[model samples]
Target: MKLTALKTMAATVALGVSMAGAAFAADLRIAYTGYSTDNTFWIGVAKAAAARADEMGVELLDLTASSPDAAAQKDAVDRAINMGVDGIIIGSVDNRAFDASLDSAKRKGIPVVAVDTGIEHDHVSSLVQTDNLAAATIAGGYIVDQLDAGTVLILGGSAGHQTGNARRDGVKNAAEAAGHEVIFQICDWQDACAYETTVNFLQSNPDIKAIFSAWDPGALAAVSAASELGKLEDLVIVGFDGNPANLVSIEAGEQAATIKQDNTRMGAEAVSNLIGLIKGESVPAFTPIDGILITSDNVAEFK
Candidate 1:
């Protein structure tokens, strides 16, 4: 989908809903646990979810983890179930770590909606997230087409993570198919680690001509590393998660492009779907939101 259309849809979802006579919304309490509180992406999701919950007259508990701790996330879910919330929304740090907690919620008849990260559980009523593999393929194709020749470095999320693996493979597959050599590194979703790795790797490998980050912060970290090494203008940098800060970098020409996810829509849709489940209504099992690749050429539309 186009960037403009996605923004318009988010606005409509935010401003078009009627506040009066939301009978199903009354007395509804929803609990949401995000991937982490430190990331701007999750912050955006929390903000949108809170706004939508308010519009629908539902009480939302933002129980986002202070850091990327899978244990904390599971505990938060367990707490919400103990509180007897009508529904729950989760952006899990580790999707595989929630079975026990989610099972308890299921026994208590509490509905769940997984967002961003896919949780494989029977209790989850819906999944709302970006098509990460497809979006990363687009970013990789851009790198291959725009750069003449050189190795590409990929800074990815934690190993064995489903979403991270999909993104990593998407870019790796595209670049390798185009005959561009690719190098990979796991940043464990830490900006400091990404920065250090980029610096050390670039110091040893001058043949690297492009960088792809699985998330926005790592992209910014790469930009910083390249700048400090006087190689900022020599490399093409692209990142995932259309973070507002990353867009600023794109506008300044510090970065080339980023795949922007519909975080607002994901948050609102998760809440909406959970409410439907709470009301004994059916909602789609999976909700895939489109991502737009924002570059200096089209960054104005997003801003």
Candidate 2:
């Protein structure tokens, strides 16, 4: 959509008015596919998307994948396409794995809006996600400012995932630039793996002064591991995806900082973008939402 139209959509969605609630010519059916139901962040995204769909009087099909795997998520998209939904919204498991399904959607004239994870397909109308690189840089800068130069461990997301890679790169760039030795580990977005990795890494590298987790759960896992190893007091911990539990950790002074994404806004905005594309209106290729860096000094506002 044009800049003016995009602004109008944002205002309407943000204010619950602008024009989102207006009657549509026909009932629109949009399929929403989240990464997984058990994930806290995706749960919030799904709830917001459902709320927005309700506000717009559209039918939202919850075709969320049961597992956090490329095959399962791709299957969900295929199901949505076979059902002939007007448009699709996805928090993709792997952006590169949906080529065939997205091509089919394009052939069928079904527009797609991606939330969180971006799919680089012409059929995908827009991507609404956190500005991860910028947010993680801020988080990294916070870590750099808080501690003396030393080893900084990064608990990263799954390999090859765009969102996770960006977060990893952001922090890595900042830490390396500041002359801190960086240790990287891929948790594959798994809590158990993160916990184990943190414990093992800290055991061998006692001089490590800080840890940056790409996701909140990973950060919490780090907190747990550090507490078990008696390293919590000596380390500065930072995380992304301001999950409630991580915020609680911050409130308790366990985690030093986090980059909190507006997941709710992402969901609602994805819905708005999908509707626009369904109506044959042009939508922007990307919409970057800023993340708030939550620290102990201001964790209360988020908590």
Candidate 3:
């Protein structure tokens, strides 16, 4: 009887140890960085990614920069590397500035995946982003189709940011393809800056018929500028990112349209790619998420 009792206790203890080992073995840490949580679009992406990480039994540590400063972002990446995370995901302010840091992460045996924006270096294991250029082209085409005969103004983001440049090029290409002339200006992605630039542009060119902004805030700025000038009806404003605020503008007829990027899908795909890399599975280096053009006609669908 004593032998039986001893055998049962030994078996129980062994099972307990095995379960603990499995629990410890299942832990994975991922570091994520992006622009800021102040924007609803980014907040939604972060929340969905966190939920996905929970579902996958992995731990995600979010590291955000105060602003869109590359130096601060690089610091966040370095901190993540020092923490020895299994993988790191970044939406870089500048694609080329992080090459050395990415190389360092690769040397540390950590896979790096870029989300929403890309890195120029080959050290990044994968990239998951929306087709920004195509989306911009769609926005431009929408604007051109809406207005009959008037000038369209382009409000762009920072000069060096690759995403901003791609968006600008797309809008320009599409507008030219449609045989419409575009008056373009760079706003550094700040709402105040965009507002000021838009107001100035409107003052100088009151006949501006449409405005296409590369981001939601910039679009809102254009809307505000137009409303203040009592030209909201004459101006058709379009934006990217399909933010909740922009949706309100669309519903109110203050803004014409926006391009919706599936950021949740972006986050989930990035995590999946990282897992594949961890498992030694071959994964595509670049993954492009398609965008949907949202206008008042189909804004309900997006909501």
Identify the candidate with maximal lDDT.
1
Comparing 1 and 2 on lDDT, the stronger one: 1
Superposing every Cα of model 2 onto the true structure, what RMSD results?
A: 6.9
- Candidate 3 stretches greater than 4 Å from native: 1-25
The sequence of per-residue lDDT tens digits that candidate 2 reaches over residues 1-303 is 599999998877877653443545146899999989889999999999999988888999998866687798889899989999999998987788999999999999999899998777777779999999999999989999987868999998888888999999999999999999999998888889989999999999987999999999999999999999988999999999999999999999899999999999999999989999888788878999999999999999988
Q: What order do you get sorting by lDDT, best first?
A: 1, 2, 3
Model 3 TM-score (2 dp): 0.90
The models' CA-based lDDT, in order, is 0.91, 0.90, 0.84
Query: TM-score of each candidate?
Result: 0.91, 0.91, 0.90
> How many clashes (backbone N, Cα, C below 3 Å) per candidate?
0, 2, 0
Q: State the lDDT of candidate 1 residue by residue for 1-303, as single tens digits.
A: 699999999887766564433655878999999988889999999999999999888999999888999888888999999999999999989889988898899899999999997888888889999988888999999999887889999999987887888888989999999999999999888899889989998999999999999999999999999999999999999999999999999999999999999999999999999988998998999999988989999999998
Output candidate 3 Cα RMSD: 4.8
RMSD of each: 8.8, 6.9, 4.8
lDDT of 3: 0.84
Clashing pairs in 1: none
